[model samples]
Target: MSDTTHAPRAILADDERLMREQLRSRIAEVWPELQIVAEAKNGLEAVELTREHKPDLVFLDIRMPGLTGVEAARQIAQLPEDDEWAVPEIVFITAYDQYAVEAFEQGACDYVLKPAERDRLLVTVERIKKRLAQRSGEAEPDGPSNGTLQQLLHSLSARVNPGGAPKYLQWIQASVGQTIQMIPVEDVLFFISDEKYTRVQTPTVEALIRKPIKELVDELDPALFWQIHRSTLVNVKSINGISRDFRGRQLVGVKGLDEKLEVSRSYTHLFKGM
Candidate 1:
C-alpha cells in the first residue's frame, strides 16, 4: 500500500450538469478519499482547472462547448511544470463506442463510459489506485506526455475523416447600442457571455451579440482564440501576460486593457507556463 499521508485530488469536466453530478457521486462511492477540487463545463475549463489545482487525476468529457477533450488533454500534457504539481492522470469520459475505447487502450490511457455503471467505475477506480500505489515515492514520469497526446489526437482525427477541415469565423456583426458594428475577428480581444448576450471586446469597440459563447465557439478559430472559461474566449494575440490575483485565480492581461480578464479555474492550463 502507498503512504496514506497524501490524499489524491481530481477534477471533472463535462458540459452537462447532470453528468458531472452523476460522475461525482459515483467517484465518491468508489474512491472516498479522492477529493474533487473543481468541475468544468467544457474542455478549455478542464485544461485550466488542471493547471490551477494540479490534481492527481482528471475526467474529461469527449465533447464540450469550446475545446474537445482530446484538445484539452494535449495542452494539459504539454503544460510546463514548475514542480508545483505533477501532470494528472487522464480519464476520458466518452459516450459508449467500441472504436473510442480501442483508441484509448492503444494510448494506454484510462477511460469511463458515460452514464457510468458502478462496476465499470469500480474497475477504473481500482486501476488508478493500483497505478498510484506503484508510483509511490517515485518521480512523476508515468502520466502521458504532449507527444503521446498529440499522436493519439492525430490518430483519432484521421479515423474521423481525412482531409477535412473546419471553416472558422472571419468577421462578426455585433450591435453597439444603436449601431451595428462589423468587427473583424482578428481585432477581437475577447468574448464574454452574459446570459443571453455575449459581450465582444476589442481595442476600440465593445459590442454585444445575441449568440451565446457555446454557439460562437463553433464559428471561431481554435488556434487564434482560446476559451479560458465557460463564458470567456480570448484572442491568443491580444494576451500580454497572465498573473494571479489575491485569491490565487489566474487573470489574463490584454495588450491595451486596464482591467485584467479573469481566467476561471477550469481554463488555467492556457497560461500554465506563465
Candidate 2:
C-alpha cells in the first residue's frame, strides 16, 4: 500500500489554454493526489515558477513564446546543487510528435501527447509515485542522466507503423526560389527546423517549406515519421543507428542523410525496453 497522506506537487506549462485545462482536469480526475502549484504559458515562466515553488513535477511544453522548454530545462539544471530547488521530474506536453523522443532523452519523466488519453496519464502518475517511493530516503535528489534520456528518445521516435488505421499525408506544393515543387510525405527523409519554416529532406534533395515543425507533425504519419528533437523529425525507416559523440551527446545517423541529428537527453525515454 502507498501513503495517501502526502500529495505530490506539480506545475503545468503550455501555451494553449484549452490544452492546459484539459490536462489539469484529467490530472484531477485520475491522480487527484497531485497538487498543481503553478501554471505558465511558456518556458521562461515555467523556469521562474519552478524556482519559486520548487514543485516535485513539471509538465512543460517543448516550444513556447519565449525560451523553449529544452533550453529552460538546461538553465534550471545549472542552478547550484545546494539550493532549495530539488530536481523536478519533467513530463513534456505537446501536440507535436517529433519532440516526443527528444523529450524523453532530456530526462523528462514522461511525454504526454496533446489531448492526452486518460489511461496514459494514469500510467504516468503511477510511475511518478514509484519514483518518489524509491527516493524517499535519499538526500541528494536523483534524476535521469542526460545520455540515457537521449538514447530512449531515439528508440521511441523510431517506432514505425504504430498499430492503427493508415493515416495518409496531405500533399504540399511550395515555391523554392524560382522553382515551384510538389512533394509527397512518403519521399521525405525528415523535417529540419529552419527559423520560421521547416526544411523537408528527401532522398535526393532538400526543399524549404513554409510550414512550421508543429504543422508538419500533424500532417506527417506518426507510424512513418517522428519528431526526435524540437528542431528535427526523421522517418523511422530512414534512421541508420544512434551513436555517442565525444561530448556524450547522442547523434542519430539516417540513411541517405549526411548530417547527424542531435537527440537531446530529455527525450531519451522513448528508446527504453526496445
Candidate 3:
C-alpha cells in the first residue's frame, strides 16, 4: 500500500464568489491531488484562515477589501519563525497583467489572470508543487520577508489607486535613432507625449517611443512616478515640488530638468500630500 501522508493543503481567496467557485472547480478537475482546506471572501478572511489552518498554500487576490491581499500576505509572512507553522506559498490572482513582472520579482509561486483558464491554473499548480517541495526541508528562504512584501506592495500600489494616487505606466521602451532602446526602468525621470509618440526623459537625455500615454500609465512604479497631466508622467524623485502659475494652473518643476510640466485639474489630487 502507498503512504498518503504528505499531500499539500491549500486555500483560495477572492472577493468574487463566482471566481472562487470557478477556480475551485478547475483545481478539482485538473489537479485533484492538491487538497484545498479553506476559502475566503477577502484578504482579512484569508489571513485569518491562514493563521487558523496553517495551510501549505494560499491563492491570494491582488486587490481586496479591509486589508489588501499584499497586506495580508505581509502579515502572514510575519508569523513567528517557528516549526509549528509552515510558510504558505502565495499565488496571486489579478485582473491586470502589468503586475506579472513585479509578482515574479517578489517570489510569488505563480499568478493567474482573472477569468481563470484551466491551462494556466494547471501550470501555476505545477509551479506551486515544485516550490513546496523545495521548501519542505528548509526554514524560511534566505532573503528578508519584509523586503519581499515591500516590493510586492510597491508594485501593486503603482497599478491601483488606493486614495487618489496616480496610476503607473504599463510598459515603456525608447527609440534612439535607428536602434530601439529599452529604458532601464530606474533611470526614467518622466514621460511626455508629442504628436504620435511619447517621449521618455531620463536623467541624461530624452528619447521618443511609440506607446500611448494612457496604457503606459498602468506600468510605472506608482511611488516613483506621478501623472501630473494627461500628457506627462513625472518621477517623484525628480519633482522639486508643485507651484501655481498666474492663471492658477499647477506646474511641476523637475530638479535636473529645466522643463516645467503642467498638472491638469483632473489629476491635481495626486499632488495633494507632496
Model-by-model lDDT, in order? 0.77, 0.68, 0.72
Clashes of 1: 6
TM-scores of the candidates in the order shown: 0.55, 0.50, 0.53
Give per-residue CA lDDT, model 3, range 106-141, as digits (tens). Answer: 565468876678898888877776666556643344
Residue range 68-155, candidate 1, lDDT tens digits: 6767777787776653455677788876355377655764468887667889999888777766654565445464554676688666
Candidate with better lDDT, 1 vs 3 = 1
Error of 2 at 196 (Å): 26
lDDT of residue 36 for candidate 2: 93
lDDT of 2 by residue, 103-136 (tens): 5445545778766789988878877776666555
RMSD of 3: 12.3
**Over 4 Å off in model 1, which ranges?**
1-5, 138-146, 157-274
Taking every candidate in turn, the Cα RMSD to the unseen true structure, in Å, is 16.2, 16.7, 12.3
